[model samples]
Target: MRALTAAAIGLAAALALVLAMTAVGAPSGETSPEPLLTTVPKHP
Candidate 1:
Protein backbone atom coordinates (compact mmCIF):
# COMPACT_ATOMS: atom_id res chain seq x y z
CA MET A 1 0.00 0.00 0.00
CA ARG A 2 2.81 2.38 0.83
CA ALA A 3 4.54 1.60 -2.44
CA LEU A 4 1.39 2.27 -4.36
CA THR A 5 0.99 5.63 -2.65
CA ALA A 6 4.59 6.56 -3.43
CA ALA A 7 4.17 5.62 -7.08
CA ALA A 8 1.04 7.71 -7.41
CA ILE A 9 2.76 10.70 -5.85
CA GLY A 10 5.73 10.33 -8.17
CA LEU A 11 3.47 10.13 -11.20
CA ALA A 12 1.61 13.25 -10.14
CA ALA A 13 4.88 15.13 -9.59
CA ALA A 14 6.19 14.15 -13.01
CA LEU A 15 2.99 15.22 -14.70
CA ALA A 16 3.12 18.57 -12.91
CA LEU A 17 6.72 19.10 -14.01
CA VAL A 18 5.89 18.33 -17.63
CA LEU A 19 2.94 20.71 -17.59
CA ALA A 20 5.06 23.44 -16.02
CA MET A 21 7.77 23.05 -18.62
CA THR A 22 5.29 23.10 -21.50
CA ALA A 23 3.64 26.21 -20.16
CA VAL A 24 6.98 27.96 -19.76
CA GLY A 25 8.48 26.80 -23.06
CA ALA A 26 5.53 27.46 -25.34
CA PRO A 27 5.83 30.51 -27.65
CA SER A 28 3.46 33.40 -27.11
CA GLY A 29 0.70 33.82 -29.70
CA GLU A 30 1.72 37.30 -30.89
CA THR A 31 5.27 36.29 -31.84
CA SER A 32 4.47 32.86 -33.28
CA PRO A 33 4.35 32.33 -37.05
CA GLU A 34 1.30 30.94 -38.79
CA PRO A 35 0.91 27.15 -38.94
CA LEU A 36 2.01 25.38 -42.13
CA LEU A 37 -1.40 23.80 -42.60
CA THR A 38 -2.90 27.23 -43.21
CA THR A 39 -0.49 27.91 -46.05
CA VAL A 40 -1.17 24.65 -47.86
CA PRO A 41 -3.74 24.68 -50.68
CA LYS A 42 -6.79 22.52 -50.15
CA HIS A 43 -7.87 20.18 -52.97
CA PRO A 44 -11.55 20.25 -53.75
Candidate 2:
Protein backbone atom coordinates (compact mmCIF):
# COMPACT_ATOMS: atom_id res chain seq x y z
CA MET A 1 0.00 0.00 0.00
CA ARG A 2 2.82 2.40 0.80
CA ALA A 3 4.49 1.68 -2.50
CA LEU A 4 1.31 2.44 -4.41
CA THR A 5 0.93 5.78 -2.65
CA ALA A 6 4.51 6.75 -3.45
CA ALA A 7 4.06 5.88 -7.11
CA ALA A 8 0.91 7.98 -7.31
CA ILE A 9 2.65 10.96 -5.77
CA GLY A 10 5.55 10.70 -8.18
CA LEU A 11 3.21 10.53 -11.16
CA ALA A 12 1.32 13.61 -10.00
CA ALA A 13 4.55 15.58 -9.54
CA ALA A 14 5.76 14.68 -13.03
CA LEU A 15 2.43 15.69 -14.55
CA ALA A 16 2.53 19.05 -12.77
CA LEU A 17 6.07 19.73 -14.00
CA VAL A 18 5.16 18.96 -17.59
CA LEU A 19 2.08 21.18 -17.45
CA ALA A 20 4.06 24.04 -15.96
CA MET A 21 6.71 23.82 -18.65
CA THR A 22 4.10 23.74 -21.41
CA ALA A 23 2.31 26.76 -19.95
CA VAL A 24 5.53 28.75 -19.73
CA GLY A 25 6.70 27.75 -23.24
CA ALA A 26 3.32 28.63 -24.77
CA PRO A 27 1.15 30.95 -22.79
CA SER A 28 -2.63 30.70 -22.73
CA GLY A 29 -5.00 32.69 -25.01
CA GLU A 30 -2.28 33.24 -27.60
CA THR A 31 -2.66 32.67 -31.32
CA SER A 32 0.21 31.18 -33.34
CA PRO A 33 0.39 31.43 -37.11
CA GLU A 34 1.24 28.65 -39.55
CA PRO A 35 2.95 30.13 -42.65
CA LEU A 36 2.78 26.92 -44.60
CA LEU A 37 -0.96 26.68 -44.13
CA THR A 38 -1.44 30.33 -45.05
CA THR A 39 0.66 30.53 -48.22
CA VAL A 40 0.38 28.63 -51.54
CA PRO A 41 -2.16 29.12 -54.37
CA LYS A 42 -2.21 32.79 -53.54
CA HIS A 43 -2.57 35.20 -56.57
CA PRO A 44 -1.60 32.24 -58.80
Candidate 3:
Protein backbone atom coordinates (compact mmCIF):
# COMPACT_ATOMS: atom_id res chain seq x y z
CA MET A 1 0.00 0.00 0.00
CA ARG A 2 2.77 2.37 0.92
CA ALA A 3 4.60 1.67 -2.32
CA LEU A 4 1.50 2.26 -4.39
CA THR A 5 0.81 5.52 -2.61
CA ALA A 6 4.38 6.69 -3.20
CA ALA A 7 4.24 5.74 -6.86
CA ALA A 8 1.02 7.67 -7.33
CA ILE A 9 2.45 10.72 -5.65
CA GLY A 10 5.55 10.56 -7.81
CA LEU A 11 3.49 10.33 -10.96
CA ALA A 12 1.33 13.25 -9.90
CA ALA A 13 4.39 15.33 -9.07
CA ALA A 14 5.92 14.66 -12.47
CA LEU A 15 2.71 15.64 -14.24
CA ALA A 16 2.41 18.81 -12.20
CA LEU A 17 5.98 19.76 -12.95
CA VAL A 18 5.44 19.31 -16.66
CA LEU A 19 2.27 21.39 -16.54
CA ALA A 20 3.95 24.17 -14.61
CA MET A 21 6.88 24.29 -16.94
CA THR A 22 4.65 24.45 -19.99
CA ALA A 23 2.44 27.10 -18.42
CA VAL A 24 5.41 29.50 -18.14
CA GLY A 25 7.05 28.37 -21.36
CA ALA A 26 6.78 29.64 -24.92
CA PRO A 27 3.45 29.43 -26.73
CA SER A 28 3.07 25.94 -28.12
CA GLY A 29 -0.14 26.73 -29.97
CA GLU A 30 1.49 27.72 -33.22
CA THR A 31 -0.46 26.32 -36.14
CA SER A 32 1.26 23.60 -38.04
CA PRO A 33 2.06 24.42 -41.66
CA GLU A 34 -0.26 22.82 -44.15
CA PRO A 35 1.21 19.66 -45.53
CA LEU A 36 2.47 19.82 -49.09
CA LEU A 37 0.56 16.90 -50.46
CA THR A 38 1.91 17.12 -53.95
CA THR A 39 5.15 18.11 -55.59
CA VAL A 40 5.39 20.10 -58.78
CA PRO A 41 7.86 19.33 -61.57
CA LYS A 42 10.71 21.80 -61.89
CA HIS A 43 11.34 23.53 -65.21
CA PRO A 44 14.83 23.52 -66.58
Model 2 C-alpha lDDT per residue in residues 1-44, reported as the tens digit of each score: 99999999999999999999988896558566854566566683
lDDT of 1 by residue, 1-44 (tens): 99999999999999999999988897656754855565668799
lDDT of 3 by residue, 1-44 (tens): 99999999999999999999888998658776988649887889
Model 1 ranges off by over 4 Å: 26-44
Off-target runs (Cα >4 Å) in candidate 3 are: 27-44
Measured against the true structure, the TM-scores of the candidates, in listed sequence, are 0.56, 0.57, 0.56
lDDT of each: 0.87, 0.85, 0.91
RMSD of 2: 6.5
